[model samples]
Target: MVAAVTGLGLGLAALGPGLAPGFVLSYDMVFVPDPAFTRMTFGLTGVVPRHVPSDAFVTALAAVIPADVVQKLVLLAVFVMACTSAASLVPSRRLLPRLATGVCYAWNPFVAERLLLGQWALLLGYAALPWVVAAAPRAHEPGGTRRLARALLPAAIGGFAALTVSALTAVTVALATRGERRPRVVRVVVTAGVLSLPWLVPGLLRPAGVPGDGTAVGLFAARADTPFGTLGSLLALGGVWNGETVPRSYGAPVTATIWLLVVVVALAAYWRWGQERRGAVIAAMVGFVVASLGAVSPGGLEAVIDLWPGFAVLRDGQQYVAPLAVVVAVGLGLAADRAAEARWPGVAAAAMAVPVFLLPTLAWGAAGDLRAVQYPDDWARARHIIDGDPAQGDVLVLPWASYRSYSWNHGRRVLDPLPRYLHRRVIVDDAVTVDGTTVAPEDPRAVRLAPAARTGAPPAVTLRDEGVRYVVVDAEPGTIRPSGAATAVLRGADLVVYRIDGAAEATGDQVPVAPVAAAWAVASLFVFWSFVAPRTTLSIPLLGSIKPRDPHRRRTP
Candidate 1:
């Protein structure tokens, strides 16, 4: 429990301002006030289901609690679970080593970078890696499927990205510890596949056939975040592709060099004291290789995507470094044990503090980049307007851009949240421009409408053809061409809404919710049964084993 407290402390430090009641909006981390379910929430769209179950999961929680609170709770749970879970794997029985492991895992550069990038959903998987690793060998045991499913619950909520990472960790551990061709591997695969149906089915069923944009591989592949280059940055667990997401002052030669040295020392410690755990050693090697593959993506990646679109998940290879985090955390704890054994308890304590010291900027909510803020009143007004309308036509968000630096969000760049906040389908730009190269979007609507939204005029006629009845213009206003004097009669523009002549009912492909719902039901049964089921025996050392009393014997006192 000391380790758990330490973990909570690290979380409180990292989330200082973010612990406030408002939504902490930045990059991909978007939380609406009161999210409601929609077809889009179920990944029922023309594109791959990236947020599939994660959005749906959050919406369910929001039905009981405010979404912002749910966001904070989930974020806090990430740290608490990460810290405690990492500590659980240390070979040493000493408290110092456990504390060291908890701190090292909870406050590293990877967590900082991913948090700053606002991929909280991905972090949910990252945080749960230790638990998945612990559950790997036991997966071969009886009832292991249920146990594995419970360990994977957080990743299940995180959808595709998280589940993929967890799969790598679980399968690698199972293979390394227990030889392949075993039932454990089959059980692991089946469990992951069942939970994955929510997103998997939609991606397969997507009219675009999994929505692959080949250029994304080159655009999102890992890059150097330190003077030591891509390999060094990756070794130190900080090679996220987006340079802006690196923590403040982290790339300085001195700091980056210190971090690299720290990684080297941790690896040495693992080699000396913890390497015999074949699972950790093999998982680390596998993770590093996968990450390096993305850093130096071969020409075949795009071709591979041509053959199979799901392979596109490999584009963001840096996320695969998650397993390496587990190896390093346990290694650092082992190093602490060695230090204390050498009669240098202070050094052991110093090891516990080293991660936070090296990544100092993670404190106070990534140095205030993660502060909470209120959405504009106009946004609420717009939602109310959209929800009040009985007429059915898709809501199109304008500006032909994705991220916005809104004054209300303290000038932070966030993916437009209108689609998640509103009750009906709302389309926003999906194309992302990085380094003067625009990665094409996977959304069919974006492909079909972007051109007309950019260059077409006579707003009503342009939208009427596509069945768009209302348009939302946020921050970047006036992107839409005003209706000419001749066409003004059919167009109306208010605060953020552009009303036009309604067209035919919104027409497009949508994923069937039945399969995904049934998948969740199946996974939930395993998860629930994992907690409640037993052959029925409770034993205490001082007493004989006891069987569960039948309700018919309820009068027993």
Candidate 2:
């Protein structure tokens, strides 16, 4: 029933055409790779484990299906799960109210802008919010142990979804439990902490400073010039930092409509003021305030950014709007239920259609420009050529740029895809420096190659000295031009594999993969298994006997 409702709502919301069937290389979603490249790409992120789950998921899917198809399926699943989760949180059995909640949450402006921005991992985390919220109250219920254990599945899934959401979930759990239930909260926190070690361990073991510059904090901050602009955007769930991506069609009329709906839902919640609804209202308001603080209090946000460890990973504070989005969705459901009870069934029906009518541009892709693009045949051929070489040295990708503006990728700011394509270890210039502040590359070899690649000077001697066997020049015009004196072993339509003379014998400085990375990977598997494993199986024969049980405790049926 949930699937059917989600499919129907998404179809009505015009999500089909917007669903790209090929590579959508905007922003952070540019790390697509073939199945064989997954493990190598996994290590390329250095000791930081944040990209582990996303890389693993894509790699697992790529093993069976084409990577493009896998991406499309994953996106479709995100929409379905988001709608289903929101519907489950509605608490009402009425289909109209539940469907309204689903549509309001899944087809909002936030989802649209993020989809356009290509922040799939972040959106994946947003989709998990409703599930986490639904599971929170269960921690304090009768038979709360079993309930909390059940809740860990979603909590673990949320942790793997995005670090920010994981942290937020932990905070929510801590806040929800008090007095006698504090022990249950501790258990949940400990479980989440253990589950998060894959990414958390790497982040702690090798801490890199924040990615971008000071202006980044301001640019990505949530803006609120006016009450309507601030609260309306939050209510509509559309606090995207990039103004260019937002359509001009989303003008005052749409904003006013969204504001009206929000006002109606707010009044409904106030009128009822049930315990669960009161929590939702508080969470919604708090989320809005935090999200708005990024723009309103940039200085404060900057201080927090400097002080917080994992917090730096979340550049866009507008992502906190996710909690508000979930809250608003639940409110909409409740409002619809109230309207129906008041014998105004048509009002309930109208509320269901409000999101679709107000946020029209979000349908059929934001600004009507999101679609898939196939990679050139040369990319595959070049990968094959590079993989065929039995070399022991790293390959250097020219243009020496971390982000590429490729016409093939619709001029989106995407990370270079070469590192993920080639089987051989690669040395690509990933360091970015702005105003004396620099984010250094993981491999020092990348730093050394940057100067030569920048000057377009023949770096044959340097290549030999650094043990670089081959320089793979992406011969795309207007990018960096390679000038090394070398033998062109293979030349494709758009890429050239140059084998530097006298460098074949030089064993490059190979950075050893950290043993802790392997340990984290193995541990992550066990952690994931514990979440899915049966409770009976987890309680071992000897261990269960050794552990003391509460004699007065009543077993939950």
Candidate 3:
């Protein structure tokens, strides 16, 4: 039954034939190879430490699977997991209710908008939320020794599932727990913190003192910036900051319908299961309040960003809706079960189709815009040229922009692809700031090169000083004019490569490996093993005799 539902969910998600091999969704999800780029480095550890288990996981996967295939697989995995995780949380004996829950969570406007916006990391984190919730230690549970381990397990798992969500999950657990179990919540929080050292330690060691802005507050808010939209879009679980990404087909009418249905069902669930489900009700309310506050948060989200260390990373407050989505999915499932019991099975089944009918535009590669295309042959040739060089000094990429408007990439917004494509270290000036706060690429070399790259002029002497050997200019017409110092080595339809004169002799500080990085790596491995060890023991032959305790077992009074 689980397998069938999982398969159905996957089919529904991949509604379009275009969502196949070589079909990339969005640019943010593009996997690039960088052996030196750890989660710490990628998160700008020197600026702020953030635990990014997903980065580590993806980087590790890229090592084994072909990078492009890895990209497709990651998207597929997210969709499948989103469905299955939500399904698992339904707590209903009826398969239809579970299936309904899965579809509702998986096919909603929130998933579609985030997928289109290329916030795969956020989605990945969102996908893991249900599982984290499932693993959470329940209130008033006994068996202290075993319960402590159970609590720790979810925290460790959440640590890998995006730090922002992990922190929120911890808070939710804390709020839900009371009495003796409250102490267990502390253990979970601490365990999660300790395991998150890979990103956390770096963030703590080098905090980015970036200030918050009111503009960011409004931009990342949960209210969909559309006409006559209230909490309707937020209830439908959309409210993406970039309103342009919201499908035009999902206009006010559809939004209103979804909101009404959600309210009716939620009211039914509350009336039917009131006080018994108080914890869940409170969680949903808290989640909605927090999500609704994007940027202009009265709860001091902007103040928190400025005052709190490692808080700036969570500028998008709408992401708080993720937990609310889980609550809604579970509520719908419970409501469906109740309807089935009351001889309204047909009505319950019809409710299952609500997300599909309302979010029709979200199916099949987000209205056919997410299909992947193969990289140009010139990219491969350029890779070959860069790989052949023994010195492997930094290569500079031009049309100097952080986010590239790649015509070949279906004109979707994407990070600069050069760094990922090149074999050698390539310097592409793509420093980004949130509001007025500088996030990264604030390196002196990148700062110096940004202007020259924009002008199509090579700061040749500065490049030499920075140990930059080769310059690869994307042959975009009217974007890059050949610098006087650049001697074109390879010119193709797509790219032009230049060997910088006297670059081989030029030297500078090699990219330093932080000592804490190695420690974090070791700690991350241990945490990962801890999460998986018990499961492995149960499944494997020799260790099968261990008889792992049921994680869901409830303590009696």
Candidate 4:
């Protein structure tokens, strides 16, 4: 209970006034007022299932409650789940050290950077990682896969990106643990593979898996944030790919030095006095090496991606540092426990406060970078008209790219919300440009339309020929309106919606049914069996036949 409240407090402090009713449309995070579940939501767009189950989950959940509210709940719940879950791993009887672990785990640079970048889905997998790692070793035992499924439910909702990190953690831990390696390794693969089917089935069914420019390897590599350089920043859990996502005033010499010292001390303490550190330490080291690969040797990563596009997952290397964050979180709790053993209560209290003190910018909405803003009323009007239409055709959002710096959204550069907001096949740019160099595009349609967007819109005859039923000009005032053949459907202060006359009806690509359905069926059965099976969260029959006792009990408290 205390851990949950501490998490809520940290969330309230970090998100600050931004938690007020409006949506926080920042970078990759896009939550609409009311999102319609299109064929694309279930991976029918056929390019990649990057959003997959996450988008589907949101659409269904929003059917009962508002999406804006759902977004807020998810963001807050991330902190709560992370805190309670990490606290459960501390193996301490006292509340102080466990609370220390929870706070350190919940309020760190990784969480702050990812939050500011608006990758809340990825953070969901990250929050559940502690349980995933802990429960993995027991997966070979009876009813073990069911429990593992429960641990992975959030990661499954997070789609491809989340599962990538989760798989890395589970596999490395399985390899490192002392036991019959084959069974543990097999369970890890089988369990994670089943939950991953929603995205995996689409990716494999497609001729190519994940498309993008090879240049993304260089663009998304971990970079130096502190004076200690990339290695130092990563060790401190602060080197995310995007600079804007890094918290304000972080990496300053004094702050970086103090934080680095704390990190070294905590890590050393864990090394000196610990059991079960072998698997976590190996996982963290492996994660650090993976995170550093692109930055240190981009050529190797480029070579790998050239061989197979699926390896492009390694491009945004900094996210792989998730296991390192878990290591540091657990290390902090171990250090605090050691301090209390030495009768230095002050040391333990200071350890609890250290994470908060080092990264003050994380509080109060990352110094106002995370403030929420209401969407213009014109957006809702546009959705209404589009939904009213019976014709099936694509909706093209113009200025023809993803990530809008809208005045209405307070100049926050957020992904264009049209794709998820509208009911039709919505086309917006999926290609990402970092520091002004265009990375290769994932969608061929977006690439084809890039030239059209660069100049004015394609001619209305061409638009009709291409099956564009609606072209939405969502530009701000003072932007030039290109002459085009489409009729103006609606003109509001916020946007101008143009209708392409006589456009042919368009149908979305067919997503494969059998494999995806089978995967979903297996995952559902696992979850259902998990519920029907007796709930056994304590130490199970695996891990040396010793029943794991609750960590809350202590010899001296």
Q: Highest lDDT: which candidate?
A: 4
- After the best TM-score superposition of candidate 1, give how far the Cα of residue 218 lies from its true spot, in angstroms: 1.7
Q: Where is model 2 more than 4 Å wrong at Cα?
A: 7-21, 31-33, 37-40, 44-49, 140-161, 177-179, 207-215, 224-232, 251-274, 277-282, 429-445, 456-458, 490-493, 501-532, 537-557
- Sorting all predicted structures by lDDT, with the top scorer first, yields 4, 1, 2, 3
Candidates in order have lDDT scores of 0.79, 0.62, 0.61, 0.81
Q: List the residue pairs that clash in candidate 3.
A: 16-364, 23-372, 24-372, 49-203, 217-295
Clash counts for all predictions:
0, 0, 5, 1
| Model 1 lDDT tens row, 106-198 | 899899999998898898888878888888766656556567878888898898999999988888888788443365665667668777878
Question: By the lDDT metric, which is better: model 1 or model 4?
Answer: 4
Better of 1 and 2 by lDDT: 1
What value does the lDDT take at residue 104 in candidate 1? 89
lDDT of 4 at 548: 38
Q: After superposition, how far is residue 126 of candidate 3 from its true place, in Å?
A: 1.5
At residue 233, candidate 2 shows an lDDT of 67
lDDT of 2 by residue, 444-524 (tens): 456556777777554677887777777777646334434557777767666667787666543433323575467456556
322-386: candidate 4 lDDT, tens digit per residue? 88888788888888988898898887788789899999999998888888788888888988898
lDDT of model number 4: 0.81
> What pairs collide in candidate 2?
none
Query: How much RMSD separates candidate 4 from the native structure?
Result: 5.1
Residue-level error in angstroms, candidate 2, position 109: 1.3
